[model samples]
Target chain A: MTPQAQVVEVRAGRTRRRGRLVAAAMAAPAVLVVCAVYAYPALSTLAYSVSKIDLSPRFRIEGFVWLRNFINQLTDAHFWQATWITVYFGVMLCLLTVVLSFLIALLLNKTFFGRGLLRVTVLLPWAVPPVASGVLWVQMFHAEFGFLNGLIRAFGGEGGIIWLGGSTIALHSVLVTEVWRWIPFATLFILAGLQIVPKSVREAAAIDGAGPWRGFRHVTFPLMLPVVVPVVIFLFVWAMKVFDTIFVLTRGGPTRGTTTLNFLTYRQGFVQFDFGNAAATAYLLSALTVVAIAGLGWMLSRSRRLAGM
Target chain B: MVGTSLARRLKRVLMYAAAVLVLIVTAFPLYGIILTSIQTEPDIRSRDVAFVPTYIETEHYQRIFDEASGIPVAESMVNSLVVALATAFLTVAIAVPAAYALHRMSVPGRRVILGGFAAIYVLPTLLFVLPLFIAVVQLGLYDTYIGLVLPYTAFTLPFMVWIMGSFVRAIPVEVEEMARIDGAGLRQLMFRIIIPLLRPGIFAGLLLGFILAWVEFLTPLLFTSDLSILTVTLGLFRSTMDIAIGQLAAATVITALPVILITAIFQRNISEVVTAGVER
Candidate 1:
């Protein structure tokens, strides 16, 4: 209402505008880099999925063929097989890792002698690169001289079995290596969840004549699940797109047994030089990832609401 | 009371036993890799599997460093170092200001920017790498350090921004207000007050970014075919047939050492970063 107040209000507005301008300037570089590196490539891949492109001899983009690559992928038996294998591998790996890590987290939650050292030891597998771990496991499972066979032989049992040789077993062997690398990571998350459980809640359950198992089932497990579910979903999505470990361990394998959708895409693109088909497969894989991520986000929000209640 | 105490002791024993079992399972492969790297090639090939090496040798280690051995161990290591360091530095440099702005400033569409970043994080690397491979070639950047560094930076930026934003938001606004009242400019306020408080997040981002880039396999594999530009991870995969088992083990050790050390030193930061990212 007064002239003095009007002047102060205008000054405040100008200062706010200056602040907004500075923020925009600060954020421009990251936005530019993301556009150049991530958004551009992602959009190009979507475009390539529908059009034929050849990188060999010379780079050329032919006319668009709508849904042809997708149709070919859908009709191809190898694509379906790869899809089945990818789903199977992801489901099996997620279940095993979650169970094993939950048990490990339970054990680690209790105070014991040498607990600190044990924690570090448990995480050792995660520190190794997935590709290097694959190489190590391949040696460990070597038919003749591997430590596994040697142990079997020392126990007075037959020592030779082709661990990575069989079509069925190669995929399973790759699963084992991945489980080894991922369990510790999962355990760390679960353990952190465990620590956040209010001790008083479990104590109250105990005072009400509940036993350890009952208390954990009714109180601890529910509290921990909200934290653990997102982790499981994230790991499942990661396992679905697994490439490096399988590529190193089996090269998608003795008879394409371990060729999941991700590997199949790589094989089509790089090995077969069919960029269109590869992009199509990759886009299909992305669609699956998006579904999984959406499911995770929904679960997370629902759990947060329940926790708030 | 006595019965309950006895039960407690029994449970403690069982827990420790389980802990030891987990430790053995996790550590065995690491031990095997180290033992294999130090053993003579003949011993590695011998029918009798020695849990402890009967004859230890350093020849494999020497072979990796020797140019005459025809292994690109040294070159690959240098390449990995350059690319990883560049990626870490560039990611932090770009992410810090953006995270600060997003947190402190009245930026419109903050949620959309964050959601887009998270969505990019979830997308498979294969999805981007295919198109990126073609782009790099067309731009004449293939087989160069920039080829690998660009993708690595892009891949790491999303999570780095999230982590750094959390750090920025935790800083009390009153400190910035006081500095502003004292006539400090925007740069002065950030460098003198905000940046010092952000040390932990910045260090964590650097280490996390470095590890991700260091262990990356696919990007380097697709972007570069030159052996000289290959990272140790790609080299390890490439040299499986060409090198002896001992030398292969040596190379694996070389590739894994930095990651292991960084992880060990920054265990708290890493655990915090991962749990924060997921739990949020």
Candidate 2:
């Protein structure tokens, strides 16, 4: 090749390399901030899980014990209790949210009067801050002067069930508040999914003389499942990590009936000042989240395959 | 035919009735809170509560502003506004370039970065907050606005990048190539050409990030104990016991007002963002 052509080729290679360098430079700030603020701390917490850390006089990381923290947490009865409670809460919340959202979506999918107004009203609950929702429900569940009891009395019934006072009842009360906050979000998702269903398919189902239930079961639901499955997983993960509403409403109280893994981590780190144990709990919760998400994904794919068959 | 028409009419009526029932269930708490905020203190405390306020009083709101109420309502609101706005600005500013690099430029490990961000998004906040709480103290940033903004920005960056990157990817590569051929530098191409196209995604990201940071309770609760650093959500928890029910209701309404207004104004954009994030 001529010297001029060789020089041009070398220059092109340099420019390409320069472009990649520029791209990396542009991306560096976000990467650095995430690393410094999120990734570093997360890794250090994992480190804390294996070592003894205390922050009384000053922050100090003692020698690593190497799995003792995990062993301790694994053996603790309270850990098992919190795990069971978390799984139950997550599952129940996910089921209720998805089912209720699907129902609401069906209601919303129809062309009806005042549909726009109803849509806005449904979203209002979700717009309220979770902490405020917790406080609002706490007052509503007040035994002496709450609106719930007042309505019950106005209807000529004996009132004043201790909604947030009993152990088992308090967890359900928290569940109610969570379900209230989440339903609107899930509804919007499912409603969006429903809007994408083709008109011809429904018409064909009708022409086939299938009733509404059968049409929905055979055509509409299968189409919506792919959309709904991800939402279900999202809600399940969200419910498992819930801390704000329960913290405000019950504070994981009434004999720890409502304490999930997330709350347990908070209780250990902040209240008990056992940073080691807290980190261990946090790690375990992360592991569980990974496992749950993976398992859910596998199950969803398997179900889709089975349905296809 | 007549029987079918009647059945259709009946079904319509039932649908409307069910819709109204759902609306009432959805809106009752908001209505109750507003009513409580305007009701007399005696009405709130009494067993026989007034379903409708006989006299709509502003005493609760007045008490919230009163110096004797022992709550710094204005200061906390300002703190919340500062932290939220700062977080939104920082997140978008950092995310826009990163998104451009990931989507428009030939960046290595793009998939890995995206996957890592999605994973980070799902992990419990406590996982990071525990070590962050200790680190913030050691770094002497505890109880500072910077401390709050730092974590808020970090937590919000991944989602912002994801959203903005989707928008960036939608811009035709030919447009960017033409701009570059015309001697536009990378910065000029991004700022002069790409940003105008990315307006909706940027607005959605800012609003989402701001709302998330504004509503956040745990981070502030853990990181900052100073009264002045408390946001509105954290402030509500502080005076939950000390304040009367009426004043607490007022506080709740005040805390929720900005969010309500934003949602009302940007309802379509917000919903679009949410649906887009999920659909992808």
Candidate 3:
């Protein structure tokens, strides 16, 4: 190689090195912030889960009792109940929101008068804060003067129903508020998916003497699964962690009916001031969440690949 | 032909019917909240539910703003504004450079960094807020604007970075190359060329950050005890117990207004982002 060619090659190498350095410099701030926020807290929580935290003598950490906190919480009946409630709430929320939103998305996909206005209104619930939505729904569910009862009375049914009073019913009422808030997200996402399902595919199904229902079942729905599955997972994860609506609506309830694992963790930490138990519960909840996501994600990907998607 | 036409007509009618039903279900609660706020306390408590106010009342609104009532609605709004705005600006400032670097440059571990951001974004806040609360206290940042601002930034950063990454990638690399060829420095290329093109993403990120911080309940509830620094959610939480229905409804409406307006104005951009985000 000529000396001048070697010089040009060396200059190119230095420039590339400078570019990498600049990139690192640019990414430094975000990397630092993420570490301070996520890493520190995560490590401390792990430590706290292993150690007993006592507040009586001014917030001191007592001797390490490894695995004791976890064992105690696992054995506790209330912890199991909270776990059951979280799973139940998340599954129901996932099912109802995905189904309802898919139907709405289909409707919205069709060209119709006032479609634009409907689209904007669909986003309203998403914008409303969960705490505020709780406030709104709590008023709506009021036994005597609530609009729901008034509507029931006007329609010749008995007016007074304690919509949020019963232990069984309050969780369902909180479920409704969450569904209301989540539908916007699911609906919008599914609608976008619907648009991507080619017109030719539908027409081909029709040409094969398939009815609308048959076409949807075979062609449209299967194509939509890729979008729907991810949305379902995202909604489920969010539903599992819902706190604000519960905080405002029921405070985990009339009984422990709505005391989800997330709420239970809050109660143990803040209300009961048992940081050790709370931290342990939090870790368990996080582990459950990570496992659920990974498991569902893996299963879905396998199914998709098998189906040749 | 007639049979097919009639069926088509029926289909159209059903579609519109479903659309209207969707609209009512989505919009009714919001309307109810606004109506409840404007209705008199007596009317709200009365058994007769009037969808429209027989008597329009603004007293609930006035009382919320009146500091003499001791609710601190006004004070907390200011606090929320400060925290949310700080979070928005800080998030954008940090996220933009990082996104540009990650997308535009030959960054090592780019995929890992992207995946890490996505993972952190998906993790429940419950997992972090406990330890975060303790750390905030330990660092002596508790009960201050910075305390909430810092955490809010961290929460919003991952999202902003992803969104802004797409925005950065949308700009052709040749644009920056040409600018460099013209002897423009990296700073000049970014500020003069890329930043101008990134306006829409910046706006979306800022709006989203502001909304997230404004609506946040958990962090502020745990971090601060000072009434002056209490956020809107915490203020509303306190008032929910003793406050009148009309007054509480007013507060809810007040809390929701800015978010509603932002969502309405940026519906298209946000919809694109949402679909892009999930479809990723």
Candidate 4:
């Protein structure tokens, strides 16, 4: 190698190193947009929880009120009521959606006539935006002209039942709408898990003493559980953060009967302009979601290995 | 052996029946909307619910175009489309390069980066809403298109990067090294060679990203106030406040059309994309 070629090569290598440094520098800014716009706000939320942030022209920030908002949130009847409602709603929604979706998946997994068309239709409600689904349900629940009222009256019943009016039925109404919208997602995930379950396992099970129920119980259901556990965690966290369906359908209403934690956060932040309490409420919700999902992920991974073995 | 085989066939027949029943229940509401959208007022109002369409009325759809999505509908739909499209474009743009970097270079802490991204992925939907809302208002971009789209890209990016990142890593590292030896720069290798090879992954990622933006209920609803961002979801929202069944059902079908058609076209692949999304 000549000295000139060596110098040129050395310069090229140095520039390449410099180029990586430049890209690395740019990396923070590029991704800082993500962190700033997304994660930073959540961090800011934590700060707001401990500090008092009043929304005036200046939106004053007073320091450190450790767990005061949480105490107040816990003390507030509305907050506790919202928690029970949320937990109840989440449990019911997850269980029903999982069972329904699995049954639906079982039916659709085989080769049959018009399977393709049924698959398309199944994706329809899931595909629509949740806000849209909420709105459609509200319309369907309408009297004198709603499709649902029409169905009820057609079945030889007096059809003037108002589903969303009272506080008792109001929350249940929202639950129904959520189940309607979310069941398809549950079905789709289980269906995905079903795809890889070996056909021969079932055949072998059937070749011996097992019946259909026993075959699935021993061979397929256990294999499907690893995937289903993660999905349940997802749906649980998702249901906790559900705001659109509630906002569109009930607006925490008749008397704040159906308010979840997320709905309360929105109410405090924007509707009532209580930024400090709102941010605090959000952090509470976020903390719960994080712990639940992390815990579920850990458990699922452990079970995956055990199941695989 | 023959009797046992007959029993197996019978069980399979029962399975098909169960699937059909589930489909009928699921399809009825949707069928109601499409039928309601096309029915005359009296036909819809008649005591009998007709499964068949007697007459086709294009009035509400025509009104959507003719009257210019009057009074907030047009603005909401346009806002939604703008937000969704921008989200799809930006997410793909940023994810491809970053994913390429992670895929190609010996980046330190790759597993940590991957895990951090996964942890962030499952953060609940509106947990960031309050702080972000304040930030948007603070930045003086509240109610602006960019305000919504920028955050949206943030939400979907991690999921995209992780899914597409793992997929890009799945491609053999040798191909890129060969391209590098043959006088291809990083840009050329990414655009000319790697991206084409990643078309399936990119296509699937883009689909999920677009759907995330389109079907997103909470974020857009929170941010936009003054200028009506015309959206089908917003149209359904009106149904909550008022009956206007004809108009709402029409809007419902309109909102649901793109999603239904797209899912139908890619039914085989969507489950994989969404299921893979769960890993992150």
Candidate 5:
């Protein structure tokens, strides 16, 4: 209306803009810190993966040898062996974690006496600290003084199998420990999904003459995929990055059997003091992780957008 | 869904038995720890596994309160509490305003910050260890409370930003405009009006941040080694590395006691905190 009123309106708009600008200003410091923290090691590792590194004080820089580190990593027989073992370890945990937990979730969802108490108990391992879980599992899997061996003997099997002490048995020990720690997490997420699934939906499907298996396959299974798939994919990523449990129980094994990518990164950087090679390996791991996570997340977000969930 | 009510009842009976098995599998470790702690060393090693001890003793637990070290467990317990509480305060202090800016404000980089959620969450902690180690060493903050506290906050701040951002967005911007209309300045509105409304969000962020910081290990394990800075888990791990097997199990039970006690005591609040997370 009036010139003074117009000027006041514009000024008020700028001030409000400043208030909202606080979020960006605050976010700026955190982003810089995260990027700097994340990028330096990532770039350093990528650089090292290509070429050799000197442990000397001179610490000379070199050009990209172009996949030489990966070649070395892959070509060495031990490296290839470790890779296969790592792959197997990752797969067993990932599959068992997803499948068994899904079944347990379905079972837990049914009406039962003391169900609430059981749900909390399922989370006990999850609540237990990781290192403690590792210790417990190791002790249980121990050959002489361990529970599993004792139980096997009690049941008339050969006792004193070296679960963590034997090369072949060590990976199995690591797997058991990993599964123990993560099953609870998977169960929790699935249980959350089951809670969200309306009773009427499941009951109505049953009312429509679906068998128990078919009812789950059609009614509950589809309802669960949205929650379950993401949990599995995310946990798969975590399983790849696993460190403490394996390091604790096997310490890269009876003969480097349990050494994982992360464990190798630590060994290279800290133990070997080969910063360059460690940096390179770290970057490769980071690149692989970011690609997998970003790709899947983008796909999920797009689908969620379409479904408007 | 069953053809007959009798058949449906039978299915429930079978399910109940299976559920009992699952319950035992999960809870037995906890039972084992408490059982092992009080029993003599021979008792644990003798039986295939002792389900029940003939006697319960306080020697294992009381050792925490005994000795001249003034309960090493207590010190580490305090260390964990200090880090966790400070992490909660520091993360919220930084993240709340950042969230408000990102959620309420439409700046040039708003979309970039919002999209950062997935990137931040999925980035494994291992990748950052190298630089973070270097940064802490350079800052001369290594092995200090601040060293552990800062990184713990950074690790958890992403969740804070996301959860608080969603919570802030839900509350209408009308409240801020009302405060502004009353001649409240930017600082006034944020501190006086907006923050009170963000109580639930802040509480949620604090609980999540506290639990994460309290339980976190690798970062602290790598970065800090000072006895003063050792966490409950760290102490448990370091002690267990070379000691009596029963004592190790005892320590495991001891370390877990706080989390279990807290969760058992505040089950409702814990769920509420996670609920805020899932909503985001």
Candidate 6:
């Protein structure tokens, strides 16, 4: 080639490279922030998990114990209990949230009078901060002065329920508050899922003489699975990590009945200042969450594949 | 034909009934909170509580603002606003360029960075909160707006980047190419061509970041002990015992109202952004 052409091509290459450099420069602030925030914490958590944190004047890593904290946490009965509770809570929360929100989404998806108003109303609960929801529910679940008890009494039943008092009962109450708080967001997701379901598909199902239930089961629900699967996994992960509502409503109380692994991590690390144990629990919870999500995703996709969807 | 019409009517009735039920279940607690906030303390504590207020009173709201009540409602609200606004602004500013780079430019390790961010997004704050807390202390950022603002920005950054990246990707690359051909530098292309096209996503990210930072309880609870720096959510927890039920309800309403108002006003955009990736 001519020397001028070669020089022009070389300049273009340099410009391209310079453009890339500038783009990278633009991304540097965000990349640095995330690394400092997430990457650093992640590494520090790993380090703290293996070492003993001595709280003398301030938080100082004394030395490495290498898996003793993990061993201690794994062997602790409370850890096992928290594990069981976390699993139960996450599973139950996923089930209730998906089912209820799906039903609500179905209702909201239909063309009806005041549909827009109802949508706004349903969406409002999600906007209420979890702490506020916790406080709201705490009042509602109050045995004497609560709206729930008042309703029960108004309906001719003997009133005092001690909703947040008993171990199992308190967990259930927390579950209710969580479900209440979660339904709106979940409904939003499902409604979005429902939106993508085409009219012609439903018409085809109807023309094929499929009843409403069959149409929903075979056509619409299947169509929603793509969205539903991820939503379920999201809800499950969120449930396992629920700290604020539980912290507000029960404080993992009524005899540690509601102490999920997340709360346990908080209790161990912050309340007891057992930073090592807390880090271990957090890591374990992360591992369990990852496994559960992976397993659930596998199961969902496998089932879909087997079903030939 | 009559029977078919009857069946259709029944279906409509059932649908409306179900819709109302959904509304009631979703909205009743909110209504009850508002009701409780307005009711007299004696009425609230009464075992035979009326769903409708027996005596409507603004005393609870008054007490929240009242200095003797010791709630610091106004100050905490201001703190939350400042932190949330700062977080929202910072998150969008950082996310937009990062998103453009990821979506538009061939940055090295782009896939890995995006993947890491997606991973971080799915993982709970529990995974990072412990060490983050320690780091904040060591950096001498504890109990300060910068401390809360920085973490909140970080927490919201990955999600904002992803959302804004989706927006950036939606804009035709041909537009940027044309600008480049016109001798537009990368900055000019981004500022003039890209950011204008990314307006919807920017608004979504800003509003979402604000809401996330506003509602955040754990970060403030863990990081700040100074009364002046206390966020509204943390303030709700602080006076949980000493505060009367009516006053607490007032605080709850005060804390919850802004988000509710935002949702009401921007329901379409907020929901669109929130459910962005969910649709097939």
lDDT (10s digit) by residue, model 5, range B37-120:
787777777746656678986676766545553337778888889999999988888788878877766645777666765565
Give the residue spans of candidate 6 off by over 4 A.
A299-309
Question: Candidate 1, clashing residue pairs?
Answer: none
- How do the predictions measure up, each by TM-score? 0.96, 0.97, 0.97, 0.89, 0.88, 0.97
Instruction: Show where candidate 3 strays beyond 4 Å.
Output: A303-309
Cα error, candidate 3, residue A68 (Å): 0.6
Q: When superposed on Cα atoms, how far off is each prediction in RMSD?
A: 1.7, 1.8, 1.6, 3.6, 3.4, 1.7
TM-score quality measure for candidate 4: 0.89
Evaluated on CA atoms against the true complex, candidate 2 attains a DockQ of 0.75
List runs of model 4 lying over 4 Å from the truth. A1-30, A62-64, A158-160, B1-13, B41-52, B68-72, B181-183, B228-232, B235-243, B275-280
Question: For all candidates, what are the clash counts?
Answer: 0, 0, 0, 10, 3, 0
**In model 2, which runs have C-alpha deviations exceeding 4 angstroms?**
A1-8, A300-309
Clashing pairs in 5: A23-B101, A45-A279, A45-A280
- Which pairs clash in model 4? B75-B228, B75-B229, B75-B230, B76-B228, B76-B229, B76-B230, B76-B231, B77-B229, B77-B230, B77-B231
The window of 10 residues in a row where model 2 chain B has the poorest summed lDDT is B271-280
lDDT per residue (tens digit) for residues A1-309 in model 3 = 899999999999999999999999999899889988987877888888999898775677897998999999999999999999899999999999999999999888889999999999998899998789989998888999998897788888898999888778999999999999999999999998888778898899999999989999888887778778888888878987899999988899888989998999899899998988988998898888888889779867975775467
* Reference-based TM-score, model 3: 0.97
Q: For model 5, report DockQ.
A: 0.47
Instruction: Give the per-residue lDDT of model 6 (tens digit) for A162-201.
Output: 9989889999999999988888888999898788768799
In the range A1-309, model 1's lDDT, one tens digit per residue, is: 799999999999999999888998898888888888789888888899999886768778887999999999999999998988988998898899998998898888877889888888888789999889988997888888888887788888898878899989989999999999998789898888877777888899999998989988887777777887877786887897799889988999888999998999999999998989999999998887788778877887787676662
- Candidate 5 chain B, poorest ten consecutive residues by summed lDDT: B271-280
Q: For model 4, how many clashes? A: 10
